[model samples]
Target chain A: MNIPPAYVLTLSGILFALGVIGVLIRRNAIVIFMSIELMLNSANLALIAFARTFAPAQEALRGHVFVFFVIAVAASEVAVGLALIVAIFRSKESIDVDEVSSLRG
Target chain B: MDWQDFLSVLPFIIVAGWATILLLVDLWIPANRKGITAGLAVLGLIAAIAAVISRFGIEREAFDGMIIVDGFSSFLQLLFLGVGLIAIAQAYDYLRRRDIERGEYYILLLYSLSGMLLMASAGDLIVVFLAVELLSIPLYVLAAFAIPQADSEESALKYFLLGAFASGFLVYGIALVYGSTGTTALSGMVAAIASAETTPVLLFIGSGMILVGLGFKVAAVPFHMWTPDVYQGAPTSVTSFMSVGAKAGGFAALLRIFISALPGAAVMWMPLTMWIAALTMAWGNIAAISQTNIKRMLAYSSIAHAGYIFMALPAAATPEVAPEAVRAALFYLVTYAITNLGAWGVVLAMEKAEGSGLTIEDYSGLGKKRPALALAMALFMLSLTGVPPTVGFMGKFYLFRAVIDANLIWLALVGVVTSLISAYYYLRVIVVMYMRDGEPEVRSEALLNSTIILTAFGTFFFGILPGLLIKMINQVGLLDLLR
Candidate 1:
C-alpha cells in the first residue's frame, strides 16, 4: 500500500485531458485515434496501479491480465480503423476530418 | 471444457466460420455470380437461426463467464440473424442494381452479424467491448460500400469517428468500474452494487459515463444528432441494416449492461433515461412530420422508437417489476424489428432504378398503382402508430403496463401521449398513399417485389397472431439469466 495513489490518478487525469484536446483540435482521424488509445492506456494504468496498491497479492495479476486484453482489443481496433481511414481516403482523396461533411444538412 | 459450452456458442461459431468460407470462396468464385454469395449468406443466417432454436432455453455460461448463451442472448441472436437474412436478401438486388455487386458486401455483413451475436451474448465487460467493435468495424465498411458516392464515404467516416469516441468512453467506464468493484463479471458487479458495503463514488461515475456512451449508440434524443445524417447518407440497404439490426444489437448490449450491472443504482440514472425517452419520442415524431425525405423521416421515426424502448429500461431497474419489464422489453424489441424492417423494405422497393426515391412526395399515389405495396406500408405504419390488433399495440401495452406497475404512471402517461402524437405522422404516410393523386410507376423488379411482399406478409401475420410470437419470446427465460 505504499504506492502513490495521487500520481496514478494524476496520470489518468492528464491522459484524459490530452484525449479530449486531441479529439477537439486534431483534424487527422489517425491522431484522433491515437488520442483515444492514450485515454484507454491511462485507464489501464490506473486500474493496474490500484490493484497493486490495494488488492491481495494473489489477485494483483488479474488487473494486468485485463490490461493485456484491453491492449489486444485496442490493436484490433487500430487495424480496422486505419483500414477504414485508408478506404475513405482512397474514395474521397483526403483525410481531413473537417472536410468530410457530406452528411451535413 | 464442456461440450455444452461449445454448443452454446455454436451459432456464433457457425457465422464466423461462414464468413471465413465466404472470404475464401470470394477468392475463387467469379465476380459475376454474386447471387451465389447472397444465397450463401442467407443459408448461413438460416443455419444460425436453427442453431439458436435448437439450443434455446439452455442457460449456460461459456469461455469462463465471458459469454452467456442463455435465453435472453438466444432471443436477441435470433432477431439479429433474422435481420441479417432479410438485409442480405434485399442487398442481393440492391447492390447489383447500383453496380456495386462485389462479393465482399455479403461477407462483410455476415462478419458484422457475427459481431452482433457476440455482443448479444457477452457476459463480461471485456467481452462486451470486443463484441461491440466486432459489430461496428464491418458496418463502417458497409456504410461506405458505395465507393463512388461522396455521401456514402462521409457517412462511413462520421459513423466511425463518433463510434470510436463512444467506444473510448465505454472502455474508460469499464476500467473505472473494474477498478472500483475488483471484478468485470456483470453478475459480480450487480452483487457488489446491491450490497450495503460503502460503494466507491468512482463506480457511479463510471456507470454514468457508460450510460452516456451506450445512449449514444441507441440514439436517444440528446445523443441522436448523428443518426439522421448517417442514415440519409448511407446506401438504402445499409441504412436498413443499421436501422434494424445494429439498433437491436445496441439495445441488447445496453439492457444487459444496465439492467444486470447497475440495477441497484436505478434512482441515480432512471430519471435521466426517462427524460431521454420522453424527449426522443417527441422530437422524433414531431420532426418526422416535417420531413419530406422518406429516409430522413424513417430516421426520425426510428429515433422515436428507440425512445419507446428506453421506457422499459427504467422499469426493468425496479426489483419488484424487473422480470415482467424485461419480457415486455424483449417483446417490444421483436415487434419493433419486424415492423421497422417491413417499413424500410417498402421504401427500398420504391427507390427508382437510378435515383433514390426518398422524398415523401415520391410516395404519392402509390396506393392506386401498387396497392399491395401501399397496403403493406400502411400495415407497418399502423403498427408503428401503436394501433390495436397489431404487435406494436401489444408491445406498447405490455411496456406501459410494466411502467405503471413500477408506480411510474407519469412516465407511462407520457409514453401514451407520445404514441398518440406519433399516430399523426405514422398515419400521414398512409394518407399520402391513398389521398394524393399522381401516376404511380410500378417497378416489377424481382428483388424489390420479393422483399417487400415477404415483409408485408410478416407484418400482418405477426400483427394478428402476436400471441404466437410472444409465446416464442416468453419461452426464452431472460429472468433466470438476469438473476
Candidate 2:
C-alpha cells in the first residue's frame, strides 16, 4: 500500500504550521530550537514525498540530493544554535527566550 | 567538476579555502600578534578580489549549472570582498581595544564572505539554500563572539533561532517549487514552468514563502523585528559588515531567483513586492525617528534602504524595464554599501570600551571635538538621506527614475516621501553633533580611521562623478538576467 503524495504534503504543511506556532508561543530556547528542527524535518518529508512523485529518475534524484544538503545544513545549524543557547544560558543563567530582550527599542 | 568549473568559482574557493587554512594558521599565532591574522585575512580578500576581477565579462555556468559566472556575480563579489576588507579594518583596532581580538573573528568573517560570494553566483535553488546557511552560521558565532557578555550572547541566540527559522521556510519553499516545477536548477525552472503541466498554486505559494525567507534576511518591514535588537547588541564591527554584506547577499538571491528563475510568475509576485517595498520604506523610516541608540537608528535606516533596493524587483518584472531596474538596484547597492560602511565606521570610532558613547546624545560636541569625524558622519547622514552631492542621492535618483519608467510612480512617490521622513532623524545626528555640547571621546586607530576616510572619499567621489561607476554597472548589469 502506497501513501499518497498529497497526504504526505498535507502532513508536512501541518507540521510546518505547528512548528511556526511553537516558535511563536514557546518561551524556552531549546524547545523553540526543537520546533525549528521540526519545521526543517517537515520540509524534508515533503521533499521526499515530492521526489517519489516526480516522473523522470534524474529529476527525482535532484530532490534527494537537496534533502542531503538540507539535512547537513540543519545539523550545522543545530550545532551553532545549541552553542549559542548554551552561551546565552551561561551569561544570563537562564535560557528563556523572553529574558533575552535587553536590546529592545 | 572540471577545472573551468573550479575557475568559475575561483573567488569563492580562495576565500573559503583561505579561511579554512587560516583557522589552523591562527592556532600557532600568539594572542598578542593576532594582527598578523587580520593582515593575512586582508591578503586573502585582496586575492579573492583579484580573482573576481579576473572573471569580469566572462559568463559561464559551472558545476552542472549549480553556479554561474556573470557580470552580476562579479560585481557583488567585489563588493563583498571590499566589505570584508573594511570589516577587518573596523574590527582590528576595535577588537583589540575591547580585548576580544581573536583570530577566529577574521576567519569567520572570511567564511561568511565566501557564503555571500556563492550566493551572488548561485544558479540553483539548492545552492541558494546552501549559500544562505553557509553565510549565516558563521554570523551566528560572530554575533556571540563576546560570549561572556549577556547582550552579545542574547544577540547570537536571537539571530540564530530566527535565521534557522527563516531557512526552514526557505527549504520548504524550495521543496514546493521543486514539486511544482520538477526542477531546482533556476535556469531549468523557467522551462519547466512554461510547460503547461506544472501547478501554478504550488509555485505561487512556494515563491511567496521564498520571499518571506529572504525578506527576513534583508530586514524588509513586517519581517524586520530582529534588525534593531540584533544590530544593537552585536559588536559594532560585525553589525557594520552585516548591515552592508548580508542585505546585499539577500538582494542578490532575490533578484536572481525572482527575475531569472520565476519570471513566468511575475504577475503573482510583482504587486506583492511593490506593496512590501512601500511598507518597508514607510515603517523603517518612521520607526527610525524614535530610536535613541545610534546603532538601532542605523538598523532602521538599513531596513529602509532594503525597501528602496527592493523597489527594483517589481520594476524589473516589467520586461521593458527589467534591465534598467536591475541596473538601478545594483547601483543603489553599491552606494548603500559605501555610505553605510562609512557611517558604521564612524560609529565604531565613537564606541567606547564598555559600549558607552553609543547613544545619539554622545555625538554632541563631536563637531567641536573632532570636526573631521563629525563632518564624515554628517556626509554619511546626508548620503543616507539622499541629499545632493552624495552617492546616495545618485543612487536614489537612478532608482526613482527606473521606478517611474516602470510606471511605478506611486511606489516611487512612497520612496520619496519615506526618504523625506528619514531625513528628520538622519539630520538629527548632524544637529546634535554640531549644535549640542559634550566632549565625545573617540578612538583614532589607524586602520579604523583609514576605513572611514576611504569610504568617505568613495561616497563623495562617486556622488559627484558617478558616471564611471554607472558605465561600469551598465556593462555588468545582469547581462545574463534572462539567460
Candidate 3:
C-alpha cells in the first residue's frame, strides 16, 4: 500500500506523451523509431515496479518474463526496421517519413 | 509440463522450426531455386495443420497457465495455418513472376504465422504482448519486401514506425492494468478486478490504451490512416495475407484480452468500442465509394469490415448476450477471411508481373475476357457486400441477431444501413467486371491453381451451408469460455 504507484504511473504517462509527440513531430523515421523504444522501456519500468509492489514473488516473475519477451521482440523489430530503412534509402535517398508519401492519393 | 500441452502448441513449434531451417537452407540453395523454399514452408504449414487436427478436442494448458489449448484457440490456429498455406502458395507465382523471389520472405511469413498461433493461445497479458510482437515484426519486413520499389520500402518504414508506437500504447496499458490489479495473467486480472476493494481508475486507463493499440492493428477507423497506404504500398500477396490473416489474429487477441480479462469493467470499455465501430463503418464505407485504386478500395472496405466485427464486442460484454455475441464474432471472422482472401486472389491474378493493374479501370471488361476469374470475383464481391445466399449475409445475420438480442437495436440498425451503403462499393467492382468493356489479359498460368479455385468454390458453398460452419464454430465452446 505504501508503494509509489503515482510516481510510476506518472513516469509511464511522460514516456507515452513523448512517444506521441515524437510520432507527430518527427519527420525522420529512425528518430520516431527510437521514441517508440523509449515509450516501451518506460512501460516496462512501470510494470516491473507494480509487480514488485503488489504481486507475490512467484506471480511477479511474470512481469520480468514479459520484459524479456518485449526485449526479444524489440530486437526483432529493429532488425526488420533497419533493413526497411536501408531499402528506403536505396530508393528515395532519404529517411524522412514526410517525403515517403509517394503512395498517397 | 505434460507432453499433451506441448502437443497443443506443436503447430507453432513446427512453423518456428521450419523458419530457422529455411534460413540455414537459404545459404546453401541457389537464389533461383528459392521457390523450393516456399514449397518447404507450405509443407511445414500443412504438417502443422495436420498435427493440430490430430490432437483436436484435447484441451490442455502449457507453461503454467501461460498458454491455453482449447476449442477457440485451436480453431483460430487452424485458420492462421490455412491463411499461411494459401499465402505462401500465392506468393510462389507472385514473387517469381516479379523476379523478386527470396527464401527470406517465406521464412519471415512462417515466423509470423507461428507468432499468430501463439497469440491465439496466449493466456496471459505478458504472453499476449509477446505473441503480438512476434506476429507484427515479420509483417513489418514483409510490407517492404520489394526493396526495389520505393513505395514498398516507404510503406514498410511507415508501418514499422506506427506499429512500434501502437505497441508502446499496448505495453503502457498493460503496465497500468498490472499496477491496478496486481496480476498479468488475464484470468488473474479478472479475479483481481472482481475482488478489488475499490474501482481501479488505472485499470480503465490501461484498458482504453490497450483498445487503441489493438484498434490500430485491426484498422478500425480513426486509427486506420495506416491501412490504405500500407496495403497499397506492400506487395499484393503480403497485403492479401495481412488484410485477412493479421486482422483475424488481431481480433482474436483483442477478444481474448478484453472479453475475458476486463469483463468486470465492461461499462468502461463497451461505449468507447461502440463509437469506434460506428465511426469505422461510416468512414470506411464512405471513403471506399470514392476510391479508384483496387488496393485502396479493399483497404477501406477492410476498415468497414473491422467495424462490423467491432459491433460484436459491445454485445459480447453484455452478460446476457456475451456467448452468442462471441460466437457471431468468431463466425463473422471466418466468413470475412474467406471473402477477403478471395477478393485479394482476384487482385493478385490480375496484377501484371511488375505489379501493375490495380486500378478499378484495369478491371474493366474483365468479365468478357476471363470468365472464370470474373465469376469468382463476382461471388467474392457479393459475399463482401453481405448479399443473400453468401457467407457474408449469414455472418451479418448472426452478428446482427446477437446485437438485437442484446437490445442494441439502434446499433444493429446502424450496422444494417451501413451494410447497405457498403454494398454499393462492393458491387461496383462487379459492375466494372461485368458491365464495362476492355481487352483484359490474364498473365500467369499458375492463376489456374486448383487450390485457389477450390477456395473460391468453398466460399460460395459455405454460404449455402452456413449452418455446418456455424455448428462447427459453436462446437468450439466459446460460450463456456465466455461464462
Candidate 4:
C-alpha cells in the first residue's frame, strides 16, 4: 500500500500551520522554540515527500540534500536559540516573551 | 570543485578561513588588549576586498552552478567588506568604553560577513538558504554580545525567534517550489517553468513564502514589528552593522532569485511587491515621526528605505527597464549604507557609557559642544532626507527615474510623499543638533572620527559627482545570461 504525495504534503502543511499558530499564541520561550522546531520538521517532511515524488528526475536528489541542510540549520538554530533564552532568563528570572519587553515605541 | 571554483569564491574563503584561524589565535591574546583581534579582523577584510577586486569584470558559475561570480556579487562583496571594516572601527572604542570589548566580537562579525558574501553570489536556492542561515546565526549571537544586560539579551531572543521562524517559512517555501519545479538551482527552475504545461500554483505560493521570510530580514512593513525593538535594545555597533549588512543581504537574494529565476511569474508577483513597497514606505516614514529614541527613529527610517529599494523589483518587471532598475537599486543601497553608517557613527560618539545619551533631546546643543561632529550628523540627516548635494538625493533620483520609466507613477508618487514625510523627522534631528542649546558629551576617538569623516565625505562627494558611481554601476550586467 502506497500513500499519496498529496496526503504527505497535506499533513506537512497542517503541521506547519500548527507550528505557526503555536508560535503566535505561546508566551513561554521554550514552548515557542519547540513550535519553531515543529515548523522545521514539517518542512523536512515535505522535502522528503517531494524528493520521493520526483525520484525519476536527476534534480530530485537535490531535495534530499536540501533536507539535510535544513536539519543542520535547525540544529544550529537550537543551540543559538537556547543560549539566548538562557541569557534572557537569567536577567529577567522569567521566560515569558511578553515580560521581556524593555523596548517599545 | 576545481581550482577555478575555489578562485571564484576566494573572497569568501579568505574571510571565513582567516576568521576561523583568528578564533584560535585570539586565545593567546590578553583580554584588555583585544585591539589586536580588531586589527587582525581589519586586515582580513582588506585581503577579502582585494580578492573581490581581482574577480571584478569576470563572471562565471562555480560549484556546479551553486554560486555565480558576477559583477553583482563582486560589487556587494566589496560593500560587505567595507561594512565589516567600519563596523570593527566603530566597535573598538565603543566596546572599550562599555566594557564589552572582546576578541569574539570581531570573529563573529567576520563569520557573519562571509555569509553575506556567499549570499551575494548564491545561484541556487539551497545555497541561498544556507547563506541566509550562515549570515544570521552570528548576528543572533552578536545581538546579545553585551551579555548579562537585560536589553541586549532580550533583543537577541526576539531576533533569534523571529529569524528562525522566518527561515522555517523560507525553507518550506523552497521545498514547495522544488516539489513543483523539480529543481532547486535557480537557472534550472527557470527552464522548468518555461517548459511546464501550466505555471504551478505551488511555485507562486512558495515564492510568496520566500518573500515573507526575506521581508522580515529587510524589515518591510508587515514584517517590521521587530526592527525598532531589536535596534533599540542591541548594542549600537551591532545595530548599525545589522541595519546595513542584513538588509543588503536580503535584497541580494531577493533580486537574484525573483529577477533571475521567477520572472515567468512576474505578472502575479509584481503588483504584490509594489503594494508591499508602498505600504512599507508609508508606514515606516509616518511612524518615524513620533519616536523619542534616535535608534528607533532610524529603525523606522531604515524600513522606509527598504521600501524604496523594493520599488526596483516591481519596476524590473518591465523587460526594458530591468537592468536600469537593478542599477538604480544597487546605487541606492550604496548610498543608504554610507549615510546610515555615518549617522550611526555620530550616534555612537554621542552615546554615554550606560546608554543614557540616546534620546533625541540628548542631541541638543551638539552644535555648541562639538561643531564638527554635529556637522557630520547634520550632513547624514540631509542625505537621508534625500536633500540635494548628498548621495541620498542622487540615489532617490535614479530610483524614482527607474520607477517612472517602468510606468509606476503612483508608486513613485508614494515614494516621493513618504520621503517628504520622512524629512520631517530626519530634519528634526538636525534641528535639535544645531538650534537648541545644551552641553552634549561625546567621546573623541581617532578611529570613530575618521569613519564619520570618511562616510560623511562619501555622502556629500558622491551626491555632487554621481556620474562616477553611475558609470561603474552601469557596467554591471544583472541579466546578461538571460539576454
TM-score of each: 0.95, 0.99, 0.97, 0.99
Recovered share of real interface contacts in candidate 3: 0.81
True contacts kept of each: 0.49, 0.86, 0.81, 0.86
Candidate 2: pairs in clash:
none
Candidate 1 lDDT over B235-304, as tens digits, reads 8889999888878888888888888777877777788778888888888888887777888888988999
B1-483: candidate 3 lDDT, tens digit per residue: 777677767888999998999899888879889878888888899899998888778776687778888888888998899888888877888888877788899999998899899998898888888888888988998987888787788778878888888898898888788777777887787788789732478888889989988898899988999999999999998999999888998898888988888889898999998899889989999899999999999999999999999998888878888888888998899888888887888888888877779898898999989888889889888888898788889999999999999888988988989889988888888899989998776764574354458667878888899988888888864654564
* lDDT at residue B59 of model 1 (Cα atoms): 84
Ranking of candidates on DockQ, top first: 4, 2, 3, 1
- What local lDDT does model 2 show for residue B50? 91
Report i-RMS for every model. 2.0, 0.8, 1.2, 0.8
- Rank the candidate models, highest TM-score first: 2, 4, 3, 1
As for candidate 3, its clashing pairs are none
lDDT at position B374, candidate 2: 94
Q: Chain A alone, model 2, TM-score?
A: 0.95
- Ten-residue region with minimum lDDT total, candidate 3 chain B: B443-452
RMSD of each: 2.1, 0.9, 1.7, 1.0
Residue B212 in candidate 4 has what lDDT? 91
Docking class of 3: medium
Chain A only TM-scores, each candidate in turn? 0.86, 0.95, 0.87, 0.95
lDDT of 2 by residue, B386-435 (tens): 99999999999999999999999999999999999999999999999999
